[model samples]
Target chain A: MKQRLSTLMAAAVMTAAFAVQAQQPMKKAPPPAKAAAPAKAKDGITAEFEKFREVLEEDNPAELFEAKGEDIWKHKKGPDGASMAQCDLGLGAGVVKGAYVQMPRYFADVGQVMDAERRIVHCMVKYLGYKEEDIRKQPFSNDSKTPDHVSVITYVAAQSRNMKIAVPQKHPKEIETFRIGREIFDYRAGPYDFSCATCHGSDGMRIRTQDLPNLRKPAEAIRAYQGWPGYRMTGGFMLTQQWRMNDCFRQQRFPEPAYLSDSITALLTYMTATANGQVYKGPGIKR
Target chain B: MTAMKTTILCAATLACGAALAEEVRDYRAEAIAMMKRDFKTRGIATADRVHEDGLQAICNRTSDHPPKAIAERLERDQMESIKYPPDGKLMGDWKAGEKLAQSGRGMTWSDKAGVPGGGNCYNCHQIGPQETSFGTIGPSLYQFGKLRGNTPDVQKYAYGKIYNAKAFNLCSAMPRFGHAGALTESQIKDLVALLLDPQSPVNSK
Candidate 1:
């Protein structure tokens, strides 16, 4: 009890100190024209990042997807004349704005919980009159081809940008999904015996230089979760949460979870639920 | 300010909620149900792997921290699980070790079963000075032998540690390369030499 009390006090003090330190200005640097050694030149990368955000915010590359996504969203195609405008994303049909943040919600029509991509697949099949096989054939995008689904989801997700994350847990099934998701988050399997918890279950845990988020923490989980469906500069393409989970499973030495798999849905349910109060701040940029 | 207030209010309500009480009581059973419903077997990776082993279950429950007595006991069990080479030799060619260390492949759904896998050491440790791109998850092995000379005991220690890291310390994030069969005994020996042999670049440079 005494040890626990001291630890609690220490944590409170540290939190206060961090809050104070965060408000202080980053160390001023000399002009980049005469920069020092690459390692020592930057005091805080925050200022450098600030510059990137200032310049890049004007013409976000995601705009390409958003533009293309909007086109794909309204266009009548997919073997029959139809548009995704009729598809309901848990906020009723044609309601794109703020819908993404409210998602992984129980859809009464489908009687299941779904993320943006799943809803998109449902819309493509139902309203757009495309087969699940044809739609799943190219859910992702590559340089050679921009899959209609990838851009469409990006546009839909962007509508909820800067909105509060409000994923519903009121439905009994939604609650059950959250419970199941937490389990999958902790489930350890694969050649390396890694669960998501192996890297993401703790604070200060990192793989290489990339700091893993402790998904159990709301603040960290929200910050991390909202930053996905990112524009991967390395791959030079947009990615959805499904792709992110798939790649992570690949890294875990686990089998591929088929596109829009239940495991991925459950994991997203757990993750986004942890992000309940964070402002949606993505289709983001990635290193 | 609104977000903070909302969070505090929710936390306060949840702190007194019966749901929170239920979660505390039934987290494990819920986890088992989740794995059964969601996980699927493919190739060498099976659904049963989602179910944690006894030691891993403890690690999961405690977030990789068990109480000292239980941890020590579990560590001993893990140590006992290690199967050293039949020849009792704990060193192999560091050249082969270096190649294995660099390649981060194998044991995934795509990897063929029984094929030798990479050590993937460089993914979490800096082994040789020549390799500039290396991970910082583990301590550097650059000059590992130069710092800690490779005696027979040291060689065996390296071999054993790589074989079953939890044997040395309970709840080590490092995988049990040999115990999990991700690497063979001979492969572990190669890795042992990669870290402990004088001629290895990890020591020479």
Candidate 2:
């Protein structure tokens, strides 16, 4: 009778252990929908910066890209003849809105971390069977040209506009990725021996009249991260954060970071977490 | 009794998780290694360019605010590295200098080697009065010669500062145009003249 009791206890404990292991991969419950933060007195918003925000709100050029992106997201064309309607964007299949802020998070199936753009490209390749090389060639848009990748990112980011950033760091990989990103931010290299930290690590530092955001802190991180997928008034292009990272590397005199590579995704993960809880106010306009 | 035991077991598991969370994960070394794997050499931009020199490493390590004594020592070393022109003429044509200040084209990966690089002064300073668009990274040099008299010492100071800004302030964000070999001695002399020459728009009304 004692032996029977021991066997029954063992079976119950094993079931409990399995349950805990299974729960690890389950997504966190979606938080209550947050209202956009009231625009506090635009302290430090330069006259030009403020002017750009005020004037461009109604007729923001990013809308054009978003429209194009929506079309491409639904269109079927690649080898598999599959539309990206069911791309799993951390919030189950085909559900688009409010998912952007949580991305650059771990995707278990891919066995890697992926940002919004990287995930989009993965869906493109996996579902549509498009060549990675062909897709990456013109990831950005020009004055007269709109590329699928650039427009799609803008569209996805807009869906999450004003949502609170909530990139998860529950997984061990996610925790380690944040450390990896911190180091990358400070890593100094190149002919100029410049790092991203050189320009951005310090507060009150300006490149020109433009104020540099010190991304180490949460407040500044939110301000900087939320402003991308922006329409550049000067460049006349809808630029995403990935393009911004690429350009910064170029200016630092470092060689180009591979497209959608782990390094870039890690950097994104770090920024996304740093930007947590801030209402995204992008599809923004920039000088 | 079994329910109580299971509850205690769960509590113990939670404690183990808390302990594991306490483990520190430092990313500095891994990030450095990742860059080594990720960066590819293209054009004039080589892989070795990532290696920080002694001075750069110092500024980086200290967060651009080195100790006063160390900064002074390093500034002195930087000052010693400057090679004055053989003829002892520090001033060059303000016209050429003004042109050089206006252009910011140089040292980019796509830029051809052996080509003359710009002073890029306008990108960081207000030089010519006619050019309303200017970057404010460095202080305004409008009336530079007018504010500080254009004496021989002043001429030498401007020349030296343009050649190696780190020699003056050890961690100034201004690039070492001369030290980095991005600009020639003649180009730097022209920049000095642009700032110190009374005839230049920087000093003129």
Model 2 agreement with the true structure over A187-249: per-residue lDDT tens digits: 765545467877777766555445668898888898768668987654466888888888777
lDDT of 1 by residue, A62-94 (tens): 656777788877776656565777788988878
Chain A only, candidate 2, TM-score = 0.79
> What local lDDT score does residue A177 receive in model 2, on the 0 to 100 scale?
85
Give DockQ: model 1: 0.21
Docking class of 1: incorrect
lDDT of 2 by residue, B1-205 (tens): 5445555565768565554444333366677677777766667766666666778777866777899999999999999999889999988889899888977767767667899878777665766665544565677787789899899999989988888888999877777888888888898888888888888777765
Model 1 residue B76 lDDT score: 94
lDDT of 2 at A54: 74
Q: Candidate 1's residue-wise lDDT over B1-205, tens digit each?
A: 5445555566768554554444455645765664566556677766666666887778777767789999999999989889988888899999889888987887776777788889888677767765544555676677788888999889988998999998987777788898888898888888888888888877873
**Clash count list over all predictions:** 0, 2
What TM-score would you give candidate 1 relative to the actual structure?
0.77
Q: Which of the numbered candidates is closest to the native, going by highest lDDT? A: 2
How much is the lDDT of residue A107 in candidate 1? 89
